[model samples]
Target: MELAKEIAKGAEEEGAEVRIKRVRETLPQELQSRIPLDKVEDIPEVTLEDMKWADGFAIGSPTRYGNIAGALKTFLDTTAVLWKDNLLYGKPVTFFTEASTIHGGHETTILTMSTYAYHFGMVIVPVGYGIPELFQTTTGGGPYGATHLGSKEELDEMERKIARFQGKRIAEVAKKLKS
Candidate 1:
């Protein structure tokens, strides 16, 4: 959630209105009670209308077996109506992710998520070494998109920088597209 906030911060800095929403949790009540979700409890669950309202998107998720998490995937799978209606076509979109290990599929998660953008005909805006942090960060951030390592609550400086850059870049692109 912190990483999403950083991305939203960058977008807001770039003059884009942002709304942060989380996919609905799919875990059983018993399992959900054990995990800490206080940070996101107040975040509204994302809806099809929100998806239609945004000019662009910065979708974030935690890696699940080197792919997009099931909760996010389930939410995305419900977008066929939008897809059929062509609501997301030509809009810019970016991706971010978190992983438990260095090789825990950060890039793969982003890459897999990009498939959604492709299907929706949204322009994929990747980081592409646009910032020094991408090259320097030992922990997270990459050409695919902003990323973070481990399940820590706080992002490292480099991770935050890269996420901000991605947010700003996407907002700029979306603005240009709008104009």
Candidate 2:
């Protein structure tokens, strides 16, 4: 979602600011798809810094075994200090995932990620609209967060609309919460 980040940055031009963070894991194949496998050591420090620096966060991953990827889980595990200090209490957070197939358990991935946010005492924001794409999109975008259904098919216009809306909506809600 590198392209989506630019869109999200633009959505913040009205005064809401957002930043993107990447938490790399140790798996060679997966790390290659995301960051260099050699970069895994940087994940925890970067994650902690980002969590402390931002008022809100949006986490994304490719689901593994119907759950958040191991790398993300490892990063979250390093937040014990934040949890102990209640650093994340009441902050707003959302999650997104990419799945390999159509029924690749994206919703479950969202749920799994939500559990992490809950542990950190962050508020989970669900997609508010009842758009047909929530039920019909072949690619991604849902009330669960922004997602990408990985397959040969490209994202349709409706899915793109929903993703942009999701980013805007989350940023707006985060702004309200901060206020």
Candidate 3:
């Protein structure tokens, strides 16, 4: 959700109202090293409900073994009920991912996340325009979306810009779709 937070912050700056929330996921012990324990536990039931209510969404997760973390996957798997009702249809959605090592299956993780959006009939928004920082910056983000550089401290100014840009882009798309 870091990317979403960036977007939301940017949207706010642009005089766009934005609401951002996180969905809680259940995870096995093996995955604990990959995600913050507090984040995993503090998730609330309202997150999913909020997802249904939002005009658009930016979903993010850490990559694991060339795919999205099991925790995030588990949370998404629960959305089958939402899918059955076709509630997510027409929503503008985008995804972002982080990984421990460079080349750690970032694309695979994004693809896996994208699959859920596809099933929900949501429009997948790409980061179309290339941000200069993506190729020049030392830390996170690329054409995919805002991403972390595997460590907390690695998230620098460039990452922040990319995150905000991604969020603003999604919000813009959501606004367009809504209109």
On TM-score, the leading prediction is: 1
RMSD of each: 1.1, 3.7, 2.6
What are the per-residue Cα lDDT tens digits for candidate 1 across 38-83? 8799999999999999999999998888999888989999999999
Task: Indicate whether candidate 1 or candidate 3 has the larger TM-score.
Answer: 1
Q: What would you estimate as the lDDT of candidate 1?
A: 0.91
Superposition TM-score, candidate 2 onto the true structure: 0.81
Best by lDDT: 1
Candidate 2, 111: how far from true, in Å?
0.4
Query: Which stretches of model 3 miss by more than 4 angstroms?
Result: 1-4, 29-35, 39-46
Local distance difference test, per candidate?
Answer: 0.91, 0.70, 0.74
CA error at residue 31 for candidate 2, angstroms: 7.8
* TM-score between candidate 1 and the true structure: 0.96
Candidate 2, residues 1-179, lDDT tens digits: the string is 53256336534754667665577555677446764345333333356777888877777777786898787888888889999999999898767777877678888988998887888779887765545677777666667876776664565666666666666666777788898
Question: How many clashing pairs in candidate 3?
Answer: 1
Clash totals for all candidate models: 0, 0, 1
